[model samples]
Target: MEEPVRWGVLATGKIAESFARELREVPGARLVAVGSRTQASADRFAAAYGGRPHGTYRALVEDPEVEVVYVATPHALHLEDTRMALEAGKHVLCEKPLTLNLSEAETLVALASTRGLFLMEAMWMACHPVVRAVADGLRSGRFGAPRQLHADLGFVVQVPPEHRLRDPALGAGALLDMGVYPLTLADLLLGPATEVRATAVLDERGVDVDVAVAARHGEAVSVSTASMTSASPRTASLATDTGRIDLPGDFHHPAYAVWTPVGGEPERIDPPEPVLGSGLGNEAAEVGRCVREGLGESPWVPHARSLRVMQLMDDVRRQIGVRYGADAAGVAT
Candidate 1:
């Protein structure tokens, strides 16, 4: 039997917890350790998830037993944390948005390339079965040339201003936090966006609360919306010249998809595998497979794709005037 890939989780936030819960679902994957800013937090998380707790992020990356570290830190810390892990000679899978902007993302990608280590942005949606099926179908002309698309993800966050979703320093914004889903879906279904136009409502903290973006990819056009102050359908659709594919609610982690060919009845495609704690296991498994194959990046979510997504997000933010301090404090020269 193949050896289980040892995993180290950085941060003890909700996302981290979810990743840990889902990690068990992947074959040949193991959660060996966890790191947090505080020993108390690490201990608490480790007790629940079954991993050795480290008091600091540095300690966790430095551990000789861990093969790869999942950087689950907030958006603002992704670059710093991923760089730190790569420098420590450990492979990394950082959470999405990857970094606050494209510049930071490029730096990390170059670092991982230089170190010849595995690195991937945790964009689980791209690894999802339904999304993969749709991507394959699109590539094979299952849905004739996509003509237009619309995707949205939103939820009402009734939290204090200090909440991460509302705090600028944490890279809080509808675009970064929630919008990436729809934007990524569009990119996957259509192609790289050739033009983008965006408008947003920024809160007192200078972070976007609601955002809408329209982008053109070749002859195809897409509309993406995200919000923190309101509820949206949390769905996505691709209208092709010959048919349309309707992704179920929370399109990012959809349970099923409906493909309607022109003049034909809709077909239901159920998810192929049971998702663990929101389908994160799929991405985790992809990372493990890439690492085991001695590959530095997963073909499913390549570094180039990640950089492109960051670049598009940067453009959207520029139009919306939402900037995180990290934009000015890039980690790489």
Candidate 2:
């Protein structure tokens, strides 16, 4: 049997906790360490997740036992946190929206490539079995040339003004946190967008409260919306002239999908239940395999694809007037 990969979690936030729960269920994976701003926080996470607690992120990355680091920091910190792990000679699986902008993502990608170390965006949605099945169907012409795509993800957040989700300095916005899901789905089925047009409503702190995006890809077009001020259907659909594929509520983490033939009844498709923890295990397993195989990037979420998505986000931000400090500093805010 292959040895389990030793993992280090670099944040003690909600997302990091979620990943730790799923990490327990992934075979050939071990949670070796967790780092947080406070020793107490790190100790709490480690006690629950089975890892050594490190008060500082630097200590966690520098630990010899940690083979990979999962970056669960807020969007503003992704680039620096990921770079630190890489420079420390550990592979990385960063959370979605790899960086605040394309330039920062490119820097990380280049660094990973140069070092010949594994690095992948933890876009759990892309690694899902059902999502993979959908990609396969599209590739095999099951959908017959996707003509249009529609997706939305949104939820109302009633938090204080200083909450990370409402703070521009922290890279809080619907587009970065929630909008990426629909945009990613669109990219998967339709390829790189050729044109993008977007509009948004910003909160008092200048972070987007709601954002709507429309883009043209090849001959196909996609429409996506995300909001932190309201709840939406949180679904997605890919339509062709002859059929349509529907991903029900929370399409980003869907368990089932439906395909409808033109003028015919809808047929549902479901992948077998995940073998381990809730969907995140798929990406964890994938990362383990990539590291063991000596691959620098995942095919499921390639560096170029990540760059493309970042570029799209940049365009959207420019149009929506959601500027971060990183934009001015030429780094991820």
Q: Please, what are the lDDT tens digits per residue for candidate 1 over residues 228-258? A: 9887899899999998899978999998899
TM-score of each: 0.97, 0.97
What's the lDDT for all of these models?
A: 0.91, 0.90
Residues 194-215, candidate 2, lDDT per residue (tens digit)?
9999999986778898999999
Give the deviation of candidate 2 from the true structure as CA RMSD.
1.6
Span of ten consecutive residues with least summed lDDT in model 1: 324-333
Candidate 1 matches the true fold with a TM-score of 0.97
Residue 6 error, candidate 2, Å = 0.9
